[model samples]
Target: MLKVYNTLSKKLEEFKPLEDNLVKIYVCGPTVYDYTHIGHARTYISFDVIVRYLKYKGYNVKYVVNITDIDDKIIRRARELGISPQELARKFEKEFFEDMEALGLLKADYYPRVTDHIEDIIKVVEKLIEKGYAYVVNGNVYYDVTKFPDYGKLSGQTLDQIKAGARIEPDLNKKHPADFALWKKAKEGEPYWNSPWGPGRPGWHIECTVMSMKYLGEQIDIHGGGTDLIFPHHENEIAQSEAYSGKKPFVKYWLHTGYLMIKGEKMSKSLGNIIPVKDFLSKYEPDVLRLLVLSAHYRSPINFTWEKAEQAKSSLERIKRTIERLRRIMTYEKLHIENLSLDEKEVYERVCELRRKFEEAMDEDFNTPKALAEIFEFISYINRKINENKVPGPLARYVHDVLMELLNVFGLLQKFEITGVSAEVKPFIELLVKIRDKARKRKDWETADYIRDELRKLGVILEDTPKGTIWRLSK
Candidate 1:
């Protein structure tokens, strides 16, 4: 059985979806005020792997991530950029999708934007008001935290404790400091929508609550985001959602990805340490970033550093190299498999065993680091088989296919190149390389160098190896 660590319950629980074999998930998405950073990549990639594994296990999932296209951040950024908030949001929203695609993240089934769901937000605020869970002050609506008795259940804090540590804002109209805004009244030159309270926009936390409910229903299977959202944000979500619907558990499972620290420090705009996702992609492969995100367990804080990325890159290369070796051995109809040698039988069994171990690790709270360790062990076994010249003939293909499936679950081995070349041109390049190889064998240095230099100019990089020459499009 697949198990997940529930942030709400604070324990590992068997993953039983509300409907049989169907999971409904809602993850809080980007604000779209700026380009997504590596911090955002870590969170989205972590969840992408989770969703991939769920599908691999034969579960139908409906994933929704809300796009906060209208917010304080967008407003501020628009003012600085000398554009309207909507214009700024549209620009960054497009950029966010590009970065997400570049990072090889699964597209969410629905990316519901706050701007498009104005009616839904207003309806929820109206319901909360009618249910006595919210109040309006000076055209602004705020959720009455005192009315929601179990306000801190998700975050594991009592109202007194929350009020003690909560940031103080000089809002004399608020009955309690723990109370949070559900709708902010419009100010001069700010965007507004018609509401019962007045012309205003929905609050940040309210947008998620409204969007998740409209898209996935009141009780979802999983609600996920960064750990930093566990407090005020998610806590407020649970409180307001349950209060609105009178549901005991708004979400069946609450999953939060741990924070990504940069060079042992938290990445922040003020710190100027934020690494944009596009910038990182320019320097490293998407799989390298995925591996780095997976090296640490999902719930454990991950320290983002060049060292960690290098280790992940090395691990990823090891898998790719092992697969390449397997590909070479699987072909050529190797003569060793006629009688099923002792080592060959052992290799087949070991590969099968590794698959089981990998599944088990994934079952245990999506333990990717341990799952990857199993993959590394299997790679080691394959290398040993290659060294001993005992590659399984047809079984080698099965081994390769299985490893690729597992690696794909982690979003690795995606072919990303700087430029796109047509399929018709590929064979001609390969033919040229082959003819050049023959020339080299005949000691035709000038001809071989000419071919090499010409291919390099065309942006194809070639490396001559003992097994053969391998080529790829240069980045």
Candidate 2:
């Protein structure tokens, strides 16, 4: 059975979906105000791997990640750029999807934008007001913290404790200092939608509650995001959602991934220390970045450093080289399964054990690092078997299949396959490489350089070794 660390229960719990065989998950997505950074990549890729493993384990999953197209950050940035807020949001939203696809993140089943769900937001707010859990102060509506006795249950803080840490809002009309806004009164020269209270827009926390509930239902199997959202963001979501639906539990499982830090400090825009995902992708292969993120436990902070990234790249290279060697052996070797050598039998048994161990690690709270260690061990064993010539053709093929199945579970190695290249093109690419090499031998510098540069533009990267020139697909 699979187990997950639920932030709400503060313990690892056996995973059981509220609905049989169908798992519904909602994760908070980007605000779409600017280019997405590495922190965004870390969180989304973590959840992507989780969903992949869940599907691999034979459970149907419906993943929803909402787009916060309407927010203070978007408005502020749009004004500074002299563009309409909608225009700016659309631009960044497009870029966000590009980055996600480039990183091989699984496409979210639903991407509910806040602007498109205004009616749902209004309906939830109306219910809260009718139920006496929310009030209209002037033109704004705020959820009364006192009305919900379990207000701080999610964050594990009392009302008094929350009041102490709360940032004092200028709206003294609130019933209590800890109460949060459900709808904010529209300011001058800002976008507004007509609501029961007046011309206004939904608050940050309320948009998620409405979108998640509207798309996935009232209580989802899992709700996840960065741990920084646990406090007021998620806490306020609990209060408003439970208050509206009168459901005791807003979500069945609350999974929070740890933060991404740089130089022992949390990565944030305010700190002016952010690395864009595009920059990382341009430098390192996408799977290398995925490995770097999955190297750490999902609930543990990942420190970003070039040294660690280089190590991850090397690890990926080892896997690639191993697979290449195994392919060559499978293509050339003859197999006698009935009379296997003792060494080949031992290596095959050990290879089968690695799959069991990989599943065990994944079952225990989705331990990706431990699971990856098993994969590395399998790679090492296969390499030794190949060197000793103890691997039969059938056994080598089985090992390759198992390795690929496990690697694809993490969404690695498969995405880098060169597309649009045909079987007939291989000999031509080799011919071009040979022609380029001959040009270099004859000292035809211009032709050789032009061919190399043109081939790069066609997504082929050429590497020169003392043995020969090797070519591979570029990211």
- lDDT: which candidate is best? 2
Q: Write down the TM-score of every candidate.
A: 0.88, 0.88
The runs of at least 3 residues in candidate 2 whose Cα sits more than 4 Å from the true structure, single-residue gaps closed, are: 166-170, 331-339, 417-475
Model 2 worst lDDT window (10 residues): 328-337
Candidate 1 has an lDDT of: 0.87
RMSD of 2: 5.7
**lDDT, each prediction:** 0.87, 0.88
Candidate 1: which stretches are off by over 4 Å? Answer: 331-339, 416-475
Per model, how many backbone clashes are there?
A: 0, 0
Error of 1 at 270 (Å): 3.1
